[model samples]
Target: MMEATTQAEVTAYWNARAPAFDGVASHVAQGGVWRDVLAAAFGAGGPRDVVDLGSGTGACALIAASLGHRVRGYDGSEGMLAVARAAAEAAGLSVSFDAAVIDQAAIEPASADIVTLRNVLWTLEQPMVALAQAHAALRPGGMVLVSDGLWSVAPQFRSTYDPALAARLPWHGGLTEADARRMLAETGFGDARSWQHLFASPPYPGDVPMFVLSARKA
Candidate 1:
């Protein structure tokens, strides 16, 4: 298990990356396949109450809102929240953003139709705890989308050329598709399944596939 203080570093790292993270949102918006995939998992209907955890720069939350879902984006980093808020305003989308950690977000039980956690698990110090919170925040039939990939499992490109680079990198082990499914099942989720799509921005290697682990509250 990771120590609690590690969260501080995580928050700081994200704060620094907050501005650049909007490129991810832009990429997702511009990409047809990814948008279609998200719509299928999240439903095409509008006005669903969606809660997005670790919502950096409103990537998922803002997009959901744009599609007419009632979205709330919660993040621990104030820097990210600020950017998200501005983006929401600029887009004329009514996305509510709050500064809160995933595990401890002040969401009510059975209050949301959907929950999203994109690329957040690997950085978490208490992933199980955060998943439990997600389970609690959802309505009985609500679905949660866990979007992640084998980022750390990919070759250390920088380290391949420099011997000392590997030690400096933050190597939090990533989950396999099976690992993601098992986790949702173990955390009281039902009907867990998987979907995948490639994102265009940040330019991950073609071999490193991005996956979406969709599960419903039982």
Candidate 2:
């Protein structure tokens, strides 16, 4: 579990990285194939409400907004939210970006059609709690889309975080698709599915294999 003191350190770590976060290719919103993948995960049925947890720089939130979905993005770092808000404004997209930790966001119960967490689960000290929050925030059949990979495969990626802070995070090394599905299911989700084709080629440097897992609330 993430104690209050550790949580503060985690937020500070992300806040420090916010300034250059979007400089990375995967952190920014690139349309085309990325857009297609997101659209498919969101599923078709008109614009739906989306809640993006740990939505750094609003990449996923902006993309979701561009796809015409109502979106609210939350993160523990105010610096990240600032960046996300600026990006949303510059892109002419309307998205609510607020400061809220993943496991503790005050999302209304059964209020969203979809919940997303991209490359975020691995950083959490309490990922299961975050998943439970996502499940609670969704309508009965809402979907939760989680994206992450074996980031530890690259020493450079692991070196980005403070050693002490990294030691506190449960999945600082990263997580697998099977880990994601099991976590979702344990949190009361069902009909889990995953896609890795979109990222057949690494989106960024390193040989990290990324994946997107979508599961429905039972």
Best by lDDT: 2
lDDT of 2 by residue, 43-78 (tens): 778899999999988888998999999999999999
RMSD of candidate 2 to the truth, in angstroms, is: 1.6
lDDT of 1: 0.75
Over 1-218, each residue of candidate 1 has an lDDT whose tens digit, in order, gives 33545666678777987787756443444545556667878865658999999998777887788778999889989998999899889989998898988877889889999999987876676678778988999999899999776765565521121223223323245567787787888899997776674343433443555578789997
- lDDT scores of the candidates, listed in order: 0.75, 0.84
Give the top-scoring candidate (TM-score).
2
Q: Which pairs clash in the backbone of model 2?
A: none
lDDT of 2 at 213: 89
In model 2, the worst 10-residue window by lDDT is 24-33
Error of 1 at 15 (Å): 0.9
Those runs of model 1 whose alpha carbons end farther than 4 Å from true positions after fitting are 1-3, 23-32, 155-171, 197-203
